[model samples]
Target: MRKQLTQFMFSILLLGRAVAALTPEAAENVPFYHIPSTIKYADREIERLNKNIQTKPRLEDSIQFKAFGFHSDYLPVLSEIPDQPRWTLDLTFETYTGIEELFLVPTMERRIGRNYNKNAPYGFPSHFRVSQVFPDGRIQPVYEHNGKPHLSRMPLFIAFPEPRSSSVRLEIFKGAVEENREFFALEEIYATSFSYIRRAQSVKVSSAIESPPFWGLNYLFDQQTNLGQPLGPKNPSLSPKQQKDFSANFGHTPPGCAEIEIDFGENRPFGWLILYPALWPEGILIPGYGFPGKISGTIIPENQDGLRGSSSEIENWTGGSPGNNPVRLHGKGHIGRWLKLKLSDFPQHNGDYIFAMGEIRMYGNGRLYPVSGIRLEGFPKTEFADHMFDGYVGGQPVLFFKDWFFKTINGNTARYEKQKWEYTRQALEQRLDTLLRSTAMSIAVTTVISLGISITVIRKNRRKKIIELRRQISSDLHDDVGALLGCSMLAARHLEETLSNETDILKVRRIIDSTTKAIQAMRDIVWVSSDNQDSARQLAEKLEETLEIYSGKYEVSCKHDHLLNLADYRLQFSEKRDLLLFIKEALHNIDKHANATRINLQITVKQNRLKIIITDDGCGFDFRQAPGQTTGQGLISMRERANHMRGIFTIKTSPGNGTEITLELPVKKKPSPLKPRETTNESN
Candidate 1:
């Protein structure tokens, strides 16, 4: 119990520090920095904090510490002409494909060595434009980025609008400038839709430096980034004993030239082949450890030994450290039932030069061929040769290109968010330290006392506010639902007395309508209290559904464009509830007072402000006497709701003229006094 109290006090101290750090000047600079936008980001931070609390193998304390291990034999692509007029990369697809966004990885690593470079290379374009090219050679601009210079080493994500085209074009207005020379350089580019990355069938570049082994055009579509392979933060590094046991369970390779043959039972076309390198035993990842210095592949007929017949060399790779980045080789148009891989010049581990590989994969017809459970053979009955095709590396499944890209990009983004939070935390700490040093001993004591008193008062006030909120919600529920339900019951009782008349049928419809309104009122009240429904799109959807309930009585015309922008923005709970209620009340007023035939509701979003206009062609009331009119309470309620959301509400109406109601609201509301999810003692 005492330990629990001590921990609670420590937490309180941290809370005090945070509260003190958030001064008026400091608060303006941080926009919702305390709130996490995604669950993955929050999980990452929690895991990191847990690891920090518990001591383990201490890796480098840097952003790259959690990055995937990667290496490539070639450099990033660059423009051939340093001062070229315009550098263009055109991607032609085999069929028409829709591209919603483009993801570009800059040339961060100038060269692949023992470790990947963290800095981006020179000559990255400052501004660029992406367009769609038709088969008739007409180009339409789809997206453009003309913001500040692209200097960050991170990947650039550009969103495309209205994308459905046969081909795409990426053009640079001005190439990157360095030392009075201008050139465009990029490590990789990907056109992605909502679900998957769209791989272009062919690529065309206006000018590219196609130097072999260092720089080439292939680097642009290599699917390799400097961010390396996606790896977990707590990936285990086996101890010497563990390694020994693992080797005993999943045998290791013996020294010498090793050849493995895979028979497909029938002739099949293979376009891509991947060779996954062995995992580093010590966790100090040397990418291509124990991988052969020289590798060769050959294709042969089925059911025949590769050694007994003449085989054609399909692919060859020499001298490359393929860390977590698997060696992917293309064998386009190669049709064979049997594949033979010859590996030589093996790297030495301990005292022997041994050849070890995690897995081998072959792909054709845009799908991975099932290699698991397929019997493999070795030329000389190589020890542990079958273990190489187990579809796993260090007990973990080998990741595909798209899966790896997704994980690596998400990991990099999470790291970036972590770095931002860390910077903000450090700034807060520094300000806190300054504040502490500037305060005298008496002032510090008085401040602590005042803080304690303030905390107590705040708690009491918070409880009172919660109770008041519950009371407000309770009163609204009573007025909206209870009154309607009561009217529904009274109408039902009235229906029995006039059972044979047409008036009874009309009375039955009124009762059904009243009951539905009561149910809808209850549903709205429940929706308003829900914590999850916060997005503007959800609010708009709810509003549309509410408006649809009145479709039978009046002709409803609703227009809401810019849904994408609304989808991206979020609204506080109070703002969402109030705005929804305000619109519903306006529609309700039109139904009750005005004999309207046609109703029009148009909602537009501009400059972070949401405008709602509702008009009806009906006998309208006098705007001057609206407050004293029969429908005065509904108007007052709508105005109060709008005012609560910090919005502007106006009604323009005159006798025999149509009524127009306009509401202008900022999408984002100021911080409310009440916190989220706080439970009150009052019950419904």
Candidate 2:
């Protein structure tokens, strides 16, 4: 028991260790730039405004497309740029540097209401390569992608080989599409060096879109993303608790613009204003749902007349759909006590416009200020206007950006590890099942072989037993018939001696009797040895023949023919030999000692038992008196032989009564082979 317990504990320990190894570590918090930094991109002209292709302010923004119009000449003709119009993006650094990893987001990060090709970008090259440009202008290939179509929402993470360069270049080949118009769209790019990762900066593109505010190269460097604020390992949006007392429904309204205003009791200098999009309970609204497609706002000073026609302004700003992420507006070196916002293009709900928001956070002097009051104007409902600043999004607390990001990343890592472990466990179980089946088959084969061997051994043993039985029969013939023959020889020698002394008739008679006994013994041996005489009725026939031969010397008669009725019964070798010898001994004693005139024999079977009775009409002796050597020896031999055959022996006689001997034995149907004779006390 102790040994089994130890083994069980060891197995449990191994299982626990395996589980621990598969467990994923917590996600690490990373710092990124919240404002545009040293990043640069190619500048272009659009609507008389200088723009770039690297960045866009709105989630639905894209770069300008180039296609040959059948009648236009301003754009390149389709034939002129059939293999032309390839675009190249380059990032240069002051000194030679190498990056360990790179992340490329090809399309918008938020998956709210926008629709596009999810398997690869619409015009992305089927194949692309990233190369390192050294100071000597030697281009060394770093990584190449086969560009097989796959799900394209998460950033494509790539690791570079040991490479160092002053600049990196990404070139896209045209002709991905058969149409004359071809263009590539990318959301963002990030590069990691050692443990530090930052947005790609100082980019130079060969051709780009020129749009302001929305599709501009500079807007790409802004760290705003659909991931929203970094969340911990737990997603608050999935399981959230409402922190605000919501009594009014702001989702139903007419299709029109609405204005909201907030007042900070005293004039306070501010640098940033962040707007968080509204989310509804039970998926009533998607993330960023009900957010206006276009928004214009301004900051007003406390001394200004805060009315419909007030002209006093601190800073003016414009914003668009921030998606799930909150949009931050930077102040233009101004101090304001009143801020007003006008929103348009509310999403439709039940054929009507709906408007809602999560929260509004204002920062000034590196800290957040508690707003004094909020006012909603030109809306059907305004009772729950304070809900916008309830410090909750979708009924969940908005965690710090870094905390939320790490938690979300770590959750994904843990989930991936669990999936891998599940697959491995299933594979191992299958292997174990196969092994068990194979072992069972081996056991079955071994059992069959063992049974065959056992059967062969049993047959060999049976053959040996038959040989031993024949030998035992031979020994019995030598003991019984040889003794009788020796007696005959003695009688013949006596007769010869008497022949010279007047031809004694008694001696001659003795010779004939001895010879006859020897012949009878020989015949009995032959009958017992014969395999064909195994039935009980055959034993009676052989006994009757012995009586007939003996009748010549003494009268003998069978009282009944009951022995013939036992034809179905059989006797074993030992039983037949003992029964025949017993009867012969009784007759020899009577012939030598009793002056018998008539002898009667009776044999019968009753209830599967055989009974034999022999009687003589002669001078009988006392049943308890001791007899002479020869007579006593013969009598004891008869009794012992009968006992050995598992039969009962009885003698009834008196001085004047005739002697009677009876034997009863159970009949054997299927007799066994001969066995060695057992030594009895009668012989001793």
Candidate 3:
């Protein structure tokens, strides 16, 4: 029996494949029919009678019939049908052309009464009715008027028995004008048997209902096969095989109808199932099959009407009412079970066909689990205590204070460091100023002290020089005068002794004359020193007198000239003394040392210089050797006097030649005051 059933199912599947192979245009125009064995006799009798009593012959080309049958109990377990003394027959017919004008030849069987094992009338009945099956799997009735069938726009038909019964039989036929035969194509048919059974009030809900992942599915509505093909001529009816083939081609298994099994393990606690029905196909908006239902789990209708025949106990399982309806299943026992979905009714309302599933949740015993491992919709809120505790006991305040203090201290330190640098710079500048001042004061003090010392030393040196000059002058005067006196005495003594002889008397007279002149010249020198006359002029007068006195001894004569105005001459007293000494020395040298016949003394003054020239016609010595050979005191005194007066003295002489002494002393208009000094003793 199982093998036979399997073969039958295989045959049905093969028929669907054959229908799919037809060309789209042919399939669109073709009509299909389903004939059951119970209805076959009625249809065949009509065909046979029409063949025998042919008038304007009914053409086989006008229509064709194909047949298929199922034992009707093959799907008994699935359909929940009961076994009884019952039989059922299903029929379908299709018309290609003249669909409005076509009619089914009803059989003589009346629908009012039932009799077991009794045959009904065999001829076509006068009353004909037409119906259609809609795409949503709805069967809608059509009215019969004046023995003619009125077809509804729907594509499904439903005919109920006069009295409710477990079994039913139906016959169907098709008729169209012969002329429209060429426009007719017959394609397929479909049939189904429904058996009545007492339904149990207690409903069983599955433990788990699994849904497929909701990615990449397109939604559609009223989806028919070969929709693009042109509608061809209609046919009146379809055979059983034709209906099966047509349904196999045009009918579609609804999305989500695939049975899915879910296991939540054993002995799970009761929980609430929150299904997101929004994930279903948009076709859920349809009126019948697509609507939510309570048969599989727990359903809350989105529409108010619920399901069709909602008052009937059997239809109470259909779920749509209206408005904001939601489907929720409670109890955790439903976690593991297999669920089968029905989709045939979805096309009645919404046109879309996409299938989807939103987040599903299960709440049980203070625990929640997601239907597909999805989490709750929103993030969980944190507790206030957690935040408060985190803020405390972390030493965050100390860290913050340290950071702030460090920054503050760093800034202050930087500022103070800058100030310190500036202070150091200021101190250095002050020190530099102090050092410069100290150096300048030291230099000034040292310079002043040095200048004072230098002045004192210079003055003392000048005083010593003045005393030396006075001594030198006195010594020079004494020596010259003493020497002249000695010569005068000797001459006088010789004259007295030689008075009796004539030749000696002349020599003695000459000697006595020289001595008297010498005494007079020395008196003149003394007179000039006391008189305070210009030293140069006085010295010139004395020199002339000395030379005259020396003339008796050596034939000497002195001449003096004063060219400078006496009042205008500015010689210092020391300089006058020096000039007098220089001239005296020259005259003395002529008297004592020059053994010559005559001497000449000349004094000349010009500009700031006084020149004294003494020439002697005497035996002169070599001047270079004279200073070394003789006591050069006179020469040394003359040179010293000249140097004291800032003058120049020169001697010109040679052996056997006359000697000349030149003294050139510069005279200044405003001579410096002579330095006073105590006289030092000098040997004559």
Worst 10 residues of 3 by lDDT: 214-223
Local distance difference test values of all predictions, in order: 0.63, 0.59, 0.39
> Which of the predicted structures, 1 or 2, would earn the higher lDDT when compared with the native?
1
Question: Is 1 or 2 the stronger prediction by TM-score?
Answer: 1
On residues 248-367, what C-alpha lDDT tens digit does candidate 3 reach at each position?
A: 111243433321122232323434443332212222322122233333432222223433221111112243321112233444233232121222222322344322222233445445
Cα-based TM-score, every candidate? 0.44, 0.43, 0.26
The residue ranges of model 2 lying beyond 4 angstroms of the native Cα positions read 1-87, 90-103, 108-152, 156-185, 189-204, 208-257, 263-269, 284-287, 302-325, 363-372, 382-386, 396-406, 431-684
Candidate 2, 601-663: lDDT as tens digits: 888887889899999987888745745642577888987898898899998887767799899
Error of 2 at 141 (Å): 15
Give the Å error, residue 595, model 2: 48
Candidate 3 lDDT score at position 259: 19
- In model 3, which runs have C-alpha deviations exceeding 4 angstroms? 1-582, 593-598, 604-610, 618-649, 653-657, 665-684
Candidate achieving higher lDDT, 2 or 3: 2
